[model samples]
Structure formats: structure tokens, C-alpha cells
Target: MNFSLKRSLTFTIILGIFASCSTSTEEPWSIEGKSDQEVMAIADSLAKTFIMVDGHVDLPYRMNIKGFMITKTVEDVSVETTGNFDFPKSKRGGLDAPFMSIYIPAGYQETGGAKNFADSLIDMVSRLPVTFPTMFAMANTPADIEVNFDQGLISLPMGMENGAPIEDDINNVKYFFDRGIRYITLTHSKDNQISDSSYDTLNTWNGISPFGEQVIAEMNKWGIMVDISHVTDSAAFDALRLTKAPVIASHSSCRRFTPEFERNMPDTLIYALAENGGVIHINFGSTFLSKESRDKFDKMREDLTNYRAENGLSSDDSVYTAYANQYAIDNDVYEDVQKVADHIDHVVSLVGIDYVAFGSDYDGVGDSLPKGLKDVSTYPNLLNELLKRGYTPKEIEKICYKNTFRVWRKVQEVAQGLQ
Candidate 1:
């Protein structure tokens, strides 16, 4: 070969090497920004491209109370509503799959009709596809969420927020699983047959009732994710030790932030959850995120309870309800959206990003949502905050959906093994 031709080839190879090096050294989209707006645009793009799966959303319960007929196609969720979640807002925020919370009130545990109530809520979620086939569909697995994402439809996976509906029947786990319920929170605000709750002073089972242990095992055997959000610290620890598969704090934040708030997971539990290959989806409620806000809210509840006792009024009394609402308005306590990201940062700093995800308790937290994340359309804002805090696009993607998907797939694999 001629020397000139050899030199030309060498030059081409050198140029190609340099170009590859340059591309590899370039900053990720998350960090390659000159201004807040530029970073926000990058965050927005990432939000749309990635699948964001919120572990809990109480849209079904919210709509049920408002008398919004779920069986009929009267008003589409694609349009605006007075609530925190709607199809249009979800699309705008790039939320692809939000697990519809079939939340059973703690009162149902004593009402004797918990199962019937849970079934009705499940029916309400099941009717979403029938009512609006073009915009929404039901998802029972991680794969279903992927398919719905590809088809440009939102997936409404259901999670039973309280285990009272299981109704002392172990088979009810399989029944609910067949009905598309992927997770069970075991208990709500109060202790029940399954497990003790953080809010309840009564430590009935100490940690988990004997039946609660069976419920966790059955959940593992059936591919249902065991949720430890509202469970007491003892119960949460018990769940961690017993489950064969990874569990999830479906909608809880770091108790490290709000010191005595048992509703949030403590650092040790968070670390244990991470070591167990589980994830803690951060709740976006103001009270959950801020110690001051939680303290004030607690004081308000205490005051209201005292007033109710003095007036000889039940909790369901109109005057008591009106007073509670008025007091909340009078106080107007809220946390900044940055605080929500701060919880994420706490988890990441402690256990890395893979153990964290979003579980904004939208429609369930009432008017106490963090400032910038008041609705489903505001996820990008939180992503922007993460980006500003040096989270790469890949890390953000993991927090948005990949981490939860990993746990979900693991639970399914464990089920397969049991079978």
C-alpha cells in the first residue's frame, strides 16, 4: 500500500477514536444544563420517555366518595377534575402506571362488611377500561404496564390498602390476586386480625398475628407484593424477616425526617428493606415530608378530638367535620416540593437510588400535598429537583419505575418458585 493511503487510514482511525472519547466524556442530560429551565426540559423529556409507576394512588376511593359513577362513562378522566389525578394530568406528568388504591377505611375492620367493600372498590377500578377503553386499562403485572406504555394507555393496577377484606380466609389472597390486586397493606390506621398499625395504640399482635404471618407467606406464594406502609415498626420488621420475596413500603416516607412519626420507615428499616432488595416509595404529602407540618396536624387532630368529646359529638358529626375543615384552612400548612426530593435524597444517600421510588399519596392526602406536586401533572417538577441535586437520567429512571419493577418481577419469580 502507498504511504499516503496508509496515512489517510490512520488519520480516519484517530479521528474516530477522538469522536468516541468525546461522546463518552460528555455529561448526561441531567447534568448538561446552563439554567434551571434547561434542566427542567431535560427532566420533562426523561419523564415522558421513562415509565413512571407510582406505588399508590387513591383515585378509586376518592371518586367513590364523590359519587363519581365508575361503571358509566359520564365524564372522562382525560379531562380535568377537582382531584389530584386524572388522565390528562397524568399524561402531562408522564405517569404511565399508577396503582389504584382500593383503600378500605379502618372503620371497616369492625363493620363486618370489609370484603364486600373491597370488592366494590375493585369493581370500580375494573370498570375503568370499560368506561374509557382508549385512555386506560387494567394491569396485573409488570409486563402489563410495559404493554400499556407501548400502547399509549395508562395502566390502573390495584392495591388493597387494608387486609381486613381478606376476612380470615387465606384463600382471599388468591381471590384478590385473581381480581388484579397486586399488593396488600395488611392493615390501615388501626390494628386488625392481620397486623398492628402504626397509628393504633393497641399492640394487639405485637408485630403480626399468627394469621398475618400466613397472609405474608400466601402473598409470596401468590406473587402479591406485601406492603408495609402503615404497619407498626414491629410488624414491618416481622414482614421483612418472613417474606421470601422483597416487600415494598408502597406509600411511606423516611421517618428519619419526622422523628416520632411511625407511619414513615425509620433508617434501620429503610436499610433493611434495601438489603432485602426492596424499595421505599416516597409519599408526597406535606405532613409526611415535614416534621413541623406533621406536628401541627397532630395537634389539630388532638384539639378536634377534645372538642368532639366535650360537645358529646361523634366523629361523623357535621359540626365536627366543619370545624376540622375550617381549622385546616385557617392553618394552611404545607411543605415545599424540595422536601419531597429531600426524602429521596435521604434514601439515596443511605442506600443508593435503586431502593427509592415515588408513591405520592395523591387524592388521599387531601389538601396537604407538597407545593409543586399538588396533582398528577407535577412529577416533572420533582424530577427537576432531583436533577438539580445531581441525579443522573439513569438514576432518575430507576427511581421513577425500574426499581419498583425489579421488586415486582422478583415477587413474581418467588411465586413461580413456590408453585
Candidate 2:
């Protein structure tokens, strides 16, 4: 536009990029003899000072299900609301970039409108910046998030939670990339045409399907990060094998804690991911954290299922629904924020600090989030624990945003070479 404005914008973008790419230059501090209050203050300051990037947040789908309209000012998200991620809460949490998941549910595949549904969610995300330009910005790249970070705006980058939207067409990969999907979790609760889901017993494709291989290739060529969060181990390995770029477990925890949960990545996958120069963003769900929570929570659900089977009850039967609801209420062992830190610790123990970042499934995880991290405003608590455990400022910075940014930039670099 004008000379002065152009110069100002350029300066802002450059400054933001520097912040996103580098750790703080302030004299490094130690935690050897510090009191809890001192470490907590440091964590608070770092939380604000650093650029935090959550690899997955389901705000788009959360709003979509509520019939939120682009034309209306949604006070729930615009200001303080009960939801896990409102602008004020995110700002308070120092969450500069949260990738909004355009989750196409597994049923969408059978319903035959997966693509259209995904488009609707994308439109919802696109409308965010339009509706709140000063508070939110559409981020298609790490650079965009950096710029937004510098300008005191939150960046709403997007990732598709399932590949169902790709449908039977491979060309849709580029089409979605154009729509600003930076990553795609290949499958959800059931095996899809793209890849087998971890939750599915059928193992339909046995791994990435024939077309699934093409989808990964096309995505890599177009700079999309292949996400293996909910895919079967075979499919995840298939993606790791075929993708030309690095990958991300956008919202998964380690299976080392919950040995029974296939949804969480195990040591083999974590090591493989690190070898690919990828990052595994830790999920903050209670169920994803520890065995204690899993036993107390998941076992209740299993018992409910068995009870339903015994009584010849459908899952949605009023009697069964009542029992399941009460069961959930009775067993409320929400693993604390310490468990979240433990997941992060486990990942770092497996593959160093560079391979771990946050992908808290806020708004997506329902009420199963850990105590201290129940919403976007409690990152400091997690950071405080990490500081107590001897994570330095630079290491905390890496966990906050740098690692994810590194993988993101590398994914783009690979795309450049392929193109």
C-alpha cells in the first residue's frame, strides 16, 4: 500500500520470524537452588515470552457442531467462554499458533459427504480472520504464524483430522493444500480408503492403501505434513516409509504409559519419527497420560460395553446411556498436569527435546483433560513442573514452539525440492 505502512509491515514480519525461530537471548538462568515461587515466575514469564504452537486444536469442528455462523460474532470464542480455547484464554496462555483441526468424522465416509463437510469446516476457519481480523489471522505457514505472533494476533492454521475428505480423488490433495490444510491425519476411528485406523480391528487396507500411497506422495509434493495420529501402526509405518518429508503425530501420547492403548505411539514409532526428523506433539488428554487414569476410566467403559452386550442393549439405548453417563461421573480420576509433563518427559527420554512439542487435544478431548491443563490458560503450570525438573529456558522454548517450527520449515523445504 503506502511506503511507511509497507516498511512497518515488513519490519513486523521480520521481527516475528526471528522470535519464532530463535530462543531468548536473556542471560540463561539455573534451577539448582531456586524456590518453587521463583521457578513458577520464570515459567510465567517464559510462557508470555515464547511463541507457543499447539499442533492440534479442534476449534473449527467444535464450532461447526454448534452451528456457529461466520456472519455472527461468536462471543463464546471471541471473548471468555467455557470452552477450552477462547481468544482471551489463548492469549493468556501465550498460545500464538494453534492448528485448528477440520475433523471429518468416520461416519462421513459412509455418508458420502466427507469432502463437502470438510469444506464447510474450512469455511468456518476461513471466516475467523474475516470476523476478527485484529485478534486472529489465517496462517498457512510458519512465517505466517511468526508474523501474526509479532502483531499480537493468534494464528489459526489448519489441519484435517482425517483423510476422508480426499474421498476417492487424489487431486483433492492440492485442492486442500490450496485451502490451507498443512497436515492430514490419514484416518480416524475406522480404516478409510487412505489408511487403516488404529481403532479399527478390520485393518482394511492392511496399511496405506494403493491410493493412500499416492495421497502421501501428492501431499509431500504440495508441502503437507503427513500426520499419523490415529492411523494403525502398519499405516503409520507405511506413511513413514513413503513420505518424502518428515511427519507429525499431531495429537498422540506415548504408549509406554498406557501399554494397552494402540492410539498412543510406542517406542518404535517415536524412534522412527525422530529418525525422519519429525516431531511427536504430546496430547494432554487424561486417558493419554497414565495407566492409572486408563484403568479407572477405560475399564469403566469396557464394563459398560460388556453390560450392554449381556443385556442385549443397543449403545444408544436409554438404559445403557444412563448407565454409561453415571459410570463416567462416578470414576473421575483426571490424571493431573504432572502426567502431561511425564508424557513429554517420556518422549524426550526416547528421542531428545527436539522431537517433542504440544498438541493438546483441547475442545477435542472433552472433559478428560488433566487437572492443571484443563484449558488453554494453564500452560504455565506444565512449564513450572518442567522447570522444576530442570528444563532450561532454551529447552522450554523448543517445547513451546521451536521444535514444531523446525519440522514445519523442514517439511516445506522438502516440498520445495520435490516441486
Candidate 3:
């Protein structure tokens, strides 16, 4: 959990570049209508200078459930497939680094779920080099990402999306760190020993649990980035107030766009995060973006609950995920990646361009991404849309990767100070 890492190349480059770039804003990507090819071309142009980092991905799920080999290349997404990310697609999208998630299902909250899930995730990443030696490599820091990119490798940084595995054991956090986990989200949908979840039915600590505060302290000691996404609003505020280092939302959107969704952060908190020198990576999920889409998705969930209850089936993350995934597919609910750009714009408008980044939530949320951003490689289309919307190359670079990198360095500095 030690956050001390080597200096990032992008951090050094953008600090100097931003001084000279104009801060003017105008729409770049076509919001009304634009062809896919046109958007792709704009994305390509933006891709050349941008590092194109995706803040969050759930590739480990492919390994844990669907038994996908990390070394293999997956070309398409279907119900039977687990891998949504591959070397081919990333190269095409001009993506440089992806923070791969080792998300533990909440089911693991009891018994030894966290330990087993964490171990499984460790095994999953450990097998990546052995299975797909040519495509994937473990990256512990932002600089590692750049180094891997230089050697033509896809850098994968391990991030735990839920603190379920820690199970109130502070020492276990160290185990996660040793396994290459760089960040730990305090909670998931439901509150656990660590803290309250944004989507959890139980209020638990009614906000930040006692264990949650200790978790943050340990994470800060370890230099693990504290991820605020999926945490309750109170937990988010408490964590923000508690942490000495800058945090990252990892994959969250503006509540303004999609109100009442616990997964989306409010504007006041967004500003708070920015003021605290944190970053909010825009999530690509439509339900996190559009109010209408969220409501539809919720209704589908209610229907699924009713059906499952009648059938005497209990609902868990997997069942709910399946239902949500299937509903998105059936309903054709897709969020346009351009909407992602709008979120970036909103964050920038609130606290300047330095506080936003891209957290695609790939594979984590099935098929409910913005239009034209169907998978890992579809990111360029988003960048293209940003370009057409008038984002300069430097500004685009900041949003894509630089911003996150800076936050990491700042967090590292705080970690050092704590030590």
C-alpha cells in the first residue's frame, strides 16, 4: 500500500504544456449528429498525442467466472464471452494503459470471501504474463505504464473495486498491496465492515464505518489510492475529509446528468473532490449518465426482483448484474461516449480541466455504454467527439491520462509525508 513510486512522464510533460495552451472552450464533437467514421477519425487524431488511459475495467471477472485466459485475445463481447479488453482493440483505440480491476463480489463479505476472491484475482493477474506474455504486463505505477508502453506492452495496474476482501482486518490490506492492488474502494452496493456503499440497502455506519476510517489510514500509509466511487455520499465526504492524499473516483459520473443514482457523485462533492486535488473519471454507463436511462434500468431491476422472488431465487450482485446486463441488451440502452465528454466538460467547467479523467467501467457494466463506445477500442470515438467539441490536443491529453497521473503523484507526496 506504499504509494511511493517513480515520477510519471506525463506528469512532467503536461505541467509545462498546460502553461502555454489556451483555456478556451467550444464544442468539438458533433452532439446533434455525426458519422461513426468521422468520429473515429477525430479520435485517431487526438489519440496520437494522448496516452489514452482507461481508469477502470473488470477484466478479472472474465478470468474468475467465464475462465478467460489473460493471454488470449478476445475480439467481441457476447453473453458467453468474458474478455472485453484485448491487445488488438487497445492498439486500435490508441489506449496506453488500463487500470484493471480485481473486484470482489459482495457475496465474499461473509466467511472467507474476501481472502478467496483476492487470492483468485491475484492468480488471475499472475497468469496474465504466463498466458498472454506478449499482450499483458503488471504495472505498479504510472511510470511503469509508460515504460511498458515504450516496450509495446499493455500495462495493467491492479485496483480492487470493493473493500469486501479486507473484512475489517487491517493487515489484510497489506496483503492486497503485496498482490499489486494500488487502490481499494471502501464499499460496494451494500455496506460491509469497511464502510457504507452508495448502492447498499443497509446504511451500516450510516455513512463511514469505524473500520472504514482505519482502512483509509492504512491505505494512506500504504499509498493505495482511495477510490470514492461506489461509496455512500457520507462515506465519500468522510473519506475525502480523512485522507491526506488526493483520491480518484475511478469510475463515477455527475449526479446532475443522472440524478438520484447513488453511483453518480453530486456536483457539490465533485467540486469538493476537485478542491481537495482529487480526480473524477467519467463513467461510460448510460444509467450513470441519463436520468431516463437510469429509471428504465431501475424498473427492469424491480421487475427482475419480483420475478426472482416469486421463483424463490435470492438476489445477489451476479443475479442483479445479469438482469441489468440482459435488460440493457433487450432495451438497447447505450450511453453515447460523447456524453462522457460532456461529463469531462462539466468537471472542467467546475474545477478546470485538471480534475477529470476517463474511467470506462468496461465489462463491469454490460452493454450500457454510450453509443459508439461499445468496448475497449471504442474510446477513440469518444476522443474524436471531444475534438469536434473543441477540446485541444493538450486538453484532451490531460483528460485522457495526465490528470490521473498528477493526482497519483500528489497522493504519493502525501503518502511520503505520512511516512
Question: What are the clash counts of all predictions, listed in order?
Answer: 0, 0, 19
Q: Ten-residue segment with the worst summed lDDT in candidate 2?
A: 14-23
Query: Across residues 1-419, which tens digit of lDDT does each residue of candidate 1 receive?
Result: 54235434644553343344333446423243246676677677767778899999999898788844344454545457788888889999999999999999989888789999999988888877888888888999888988788778899989999999998999999999999899999899999999999999999999999999999999999999999999999999999999999999999999888989899999999999999999999999989997999887888888889999999999889998898878877876678789999999999999998999999989999878977898989999998898788777668879989999999999999999997
Which structure among the candidates has the greatest TM-score? 1
lDDT of 3 by residue, 146-235 (tens): 777666678888889888888757898878888888888777777888788888777879778787888898888877999999998888
The models' CA-based lDDT, in order, is 0.87, 0.86, 0.77
Top-lDDT candidate index? 1
Q: Is candidate 2 or candidate 3 better by TM-score?
A: 2
lDDT tens readout by residue for model 2, 117-191: 999999988887888787789999988887787788889999999999999999999999999999999999999
- Report the lDDT of model 2 for residue 363: 93
Tell me the TM-score of model 2. 0.86
lDDT of 2 at 35: 66
